[model samples]
Target chain A: MSIFVDGNTTIVLQGATGSEGSFWAQHMIEMGARVVAAVTPGKEGQKLHGVPVFHSVRRAHAQHAAKAAMLFVPPRFARDAVLEALDAGIPRVVTIADGIPLHDQIQIRAAARAEGAQVVGGNTSGVISPGKSMVGMFPYWIERVYRPGSIGVMTRSGSLTNEVTAWVVDAGFGVSTLVGVGGDLVPGSRFAEFLPAFETDPETQAVVIVGELGGTMEEEVAEAIRDGVFTKPVVAFLGGRTAPSGKRMGHAGAIATGSSGTVAGKVKELEGAGALVADRPCRVGELLARVVQ
Target chain B: MRLLEYQGKAVFKEAGIMVPAARVVRASENQALRDEACAAARELMSAAGIGRQAEQDPTGSSGGETAWFAPGVMVKAQVTSGGRGKAGLIVRAESPEDAGQAAVAIVEREPSVRVILLEQMVDSACELYLSISTDAGSARHLILASAVGGVEIETLAEQNPTAIQRVSVDPFMGLQPYQTRGLGYDLGFSGELVKRFAQVTSSLYQVFRANDTELAEINPLFVTQDGSLIAGDSKLIIDDNSLNRQPQFEVTREQYGTDTEYEAALEGIPYVQFDGDISLMCAGAGLTTTVYDLVQFEGGTVANYLEFGGPNYRKARRAMELCLKNRSSVILIVTFGTIARADVMAEGIVGAIAELKPDRPIVTCIRGTNEEAATETLADAGIEPLLDTEEAVRRAVAIAKGEQV
Candidate 1:
């Protein structure tokens, strides 16, 4: 009920034979997500950790009904891997690679949308449903706070998810679901797509959107929130003003490319949209706490 | 990620795309660079303006390159990332001195004195932007083109997305020239420069594919008065993730200190460049970024990126001490998002500041984490740890501006 992925998602790995792919696959499995197939092109018919392997996604689709895909393929094969799964009818695809051309990303995004499918990232840590399912490597051992509750969390920063989740938990709250939409330039889903999911979820009473500088995404979300599609009280934070000058604020999409991408600009927009914009990331949970109370 | 127009020309040239004979300004000390640039500019100026220049400039120079710039030229900024023109990172100058002055200004705006990309300007009838990258869900390399190109491409796409057309490219078969030409046809690219622009787009996409690039763009792609097409100004953003596959680009990245930032980002520490009075020491990116914002919000400037480095109290405290040694109005430590023993670290910092000749006020608001021990110790050591980032930054700024904290 939280978002695109649910408890019943049977996911496959496109680059599952590689170390990164295997490591995150183990995490996804540990998080109780169904890890049904692994595809590595030539390493077909091979199984690692008891998961079946296939040469192509078409074979994997025939073997196991993979509803979602998490990709760890390098940039070179990223394009092929993405479409192969989509063409195979895997409706949800999440990639963790960064730097494939933007044109490819645009085409992929358009293609994905055309099929009523959702793609998560090209440079991301995957998605998570606190205490239920997680993709990519977020230390679940240290995170004991996601005990299943009403707050929905969305972050562009992959590594920051752990810290943000810990905050949500320590403040006597729990997250219904947390989605880490990749931080690369051409990530699959922007906040616009994730907002409706949070809005429709009965369990999600509020949302904590963690943003960075560099893109107009925060502004876009602010406009949407202002449009009144979402009724839940939204608490947001943009994490780049203190960004050591010259450093990228947490994500590729966070780059302050044009005027619309600055933290001040984002904060003003979010605030103007009636969002209780925290000046810093630390203020996110506390601000939500007051609103929820 | 930005590449100079010349860098785009290099990719186009490498892909067997026809561009003007060009010379990039790679060496600042070498006078031959200027000579080569001047020669290339003249050759290109005459070539692209072969038939048109006879009517525009009877004295024989085009794009206002005479006197101010190398005669018959266009001056461009050869930066490593995109949106330079929009960022005011590039300028079209009238003369070499004007171009040099603009380059100097660009370098001045930047922290370093690196070379700027300046090219021979072309006279054109139309402008466009052509680009290529990975299409994730489609799982194909993609080519995108817009007849309406420039810094305003994003706006154009938003206002009229249909005007921008795309083509899915298969990896194994590579990008077909026919596919690119078809995209041109769809975008209504039918003119003398159609084949040439199509070729450039194909070559640009090829270069993008060949280099394992994240993004390669040819903006302001000019269709000149003559039957020639020129890459007017370009911007390329390569994927730092694919640097290993693209060594040449990796080296250029190193020259501009992108490699250091890239490595630091991988290590889980966010780095930002700053010019300020203080060097911050804090745990986590959220805290650091917050402290930075609060500082700026409160009228305090920061220096270079300095992290508390770790969650360990001792290492973090030591890091705090090192940052305090710099000339800042105050040494502010703040943590949010899993403070992880930050209170103990704050205690150590207070203890260290007490033992040293501290000129700055030590302000911090460390929340989260169960640090009863650190809190008691810091209080006993006579240091008051502020609980709010805003207050900490406020007190720190007042202290730095010569007010009593």
Candidate 2:
């Protein structure tokens, strides 16, 4: 069984009439995810790819029992959209908007936490249980990189996730579940939230983390591994080693301002916690190959 | 989007927060700047209501006694970089003569310093620290207050961790009056002082929300002799995404000048400069960091970190121009386009190469989304694509080290 989404996951789509929303809705459908309902406030009663569109998450849930949601709303509208999703009792949501204000993210995370639900990202590419049910902007047309297997891949980078997954797929292993947690300063789901799920999933034999400099998320991953919350063999890679101090590298969260967010510091902590950390993305596959056996 | 001290203070004043009456002495290479500095010193004295005829007391024997500049004035170096006090850029000037000298000395030391701030120094009874910052771990805006102040908060967090009180504010409810009062009480304030402190805290939060500030801090919030609270120094960092709404705060990039930063701002590319040799370019921030780390891991240094979003070739070209202008030893292009099309990135690189025709070695790696088209485009431009990350990194390092391809 995959961690978050799988064959039986009935998903509701938010902002479904937008160009990006329409494209991904069709893509998810093509990947065999049951796109049960679509939510577009103004475009209700319309159909996208033969999928019925409702005006709100509540209206859509009334018609079809959608347990999970995928949000393609813009950054400005993301907070309201996610609140609507949580209000409708959708337990899991994946928000794909980037550049969402920090205050809005805090509210979204708080609301999700209060309801015992999970919001994947405000700047994320989304999550996939590969070959089962895919939600996000992940390029489903490139199927070889994401063939279902036993390795759980979670990363802060979207394209790098695909890059590392390509290496894993080429090395004769496939991703059981891959989650792009986003590179926002305050991503909705931290590595700690997903690591435990991978550890308990029977189909997943190993976990690969592609982390970056900035924030204490990587350090938290180390703490969890050290605390024995996650007992699975974990391989990790962190970027921004060559980054100069005090300069933000595009991502709002990728700047290393203090000792807690340094690459060298994170590497030492992760390695100290019994996780084999890779120096390069390709080496992650080699490390995972050795550990999984 | 980190504003200069003056810019930050301007936003603070707009929010009705109290700050020192100050004037900025703009830096210049000619007589205009010299004239400006003299005028700035006179302005500082007049703003403090201290006449030029006031006697200069050099000894500073009685700290409580009024000096030449009545309330006294502080000339602080306005560099974007922090730790100015430790850098010896901050000086207390009691006279116009001292203020003028201080500004000139600071400008001489820091070539990048465009302005010097001369503020009316307050005789504070106590220095308390207060800040509203977004803590990623908590996923919320946190209010941090401490009776201890005048030192870097990070330093305080390390040495006396218990001195700081951190409270998470719910964005839905905003920062409540009770929460503010609780923090004031935590800082050992009582009676009207606590209420006054809470008012300042509440106003700071409003400033943070109103201006879309990522960080709003009043280091050393002063408790004057009369028990009134005023912000001694303020820092407000506006969110880059929210800059469109803050047109008044937009000129800060030019005010806080850096060659690469100005160039990046002009090009609409997120570029950060370093003193390394190789120029590294990538599509996304995460992968750019990956390439950066790998380059350093392989014993190479990066000249700059440049990332392109979407299919914008103009940004790519401008990035290439910046690298060449910096005279990097080599240029390494790592493209793993997800939403960004590889073909578009390749076309941009090809366009850059055709126009610039750099003498330095150029190496590239491409993968995902239209890889064939990207490969064909690069090949047509007489450049081979290196798809392996490890191998490409090694080659880039070798070339950077002056090795022949």
- Supply DockQ values for each candidate: 0.22, 0.65
Model 2 pairs whose backbones collide: none
lDDT for model 2 comes to 0.81
lDDT of 1 by residue, A1-293 (tens): 66766668888888878776787688778777888888888898799678989988888989899889988887667777888889999999987675555545665776687788888876665677766776555545444445677888887764345545656776777888877776666677887678888989988889888777766667777888888888788888777864533345434455554344678788898889988887654566798888996
TM per candidate: 0.68, 0.93
Predicted structure 1, TM vs. truth: 0.68
The most accurate candidate by TM-score is 2
Off by over 4 Å in 1: A4-116, A141-147, A159-172, A219-230, A241-250, A262-276, A286-293, B16-18, B24-111, B116-191, B212-215, B253-272, B280-291, B305-405
Cα lDDT tens digits, model 2, B123-225, are 6788889999887665678899999988888788889999999989877778988899888888888998887788788889999998888889999888765
* Top model number, lDDT: 2
Poorest 10 consecutive residues of model 1 chain A by lDDT?
A242-251
- Error (Å) of candidate 1 at residue B109 is 10
- A15-49, model 2: which lDDT tens digit per residue? 87877678778889988898899998888889989
lDDT of model 2 at position A63: 91
- List per-prediction Cα lDDT, in the order shown: 0.65, 0.81
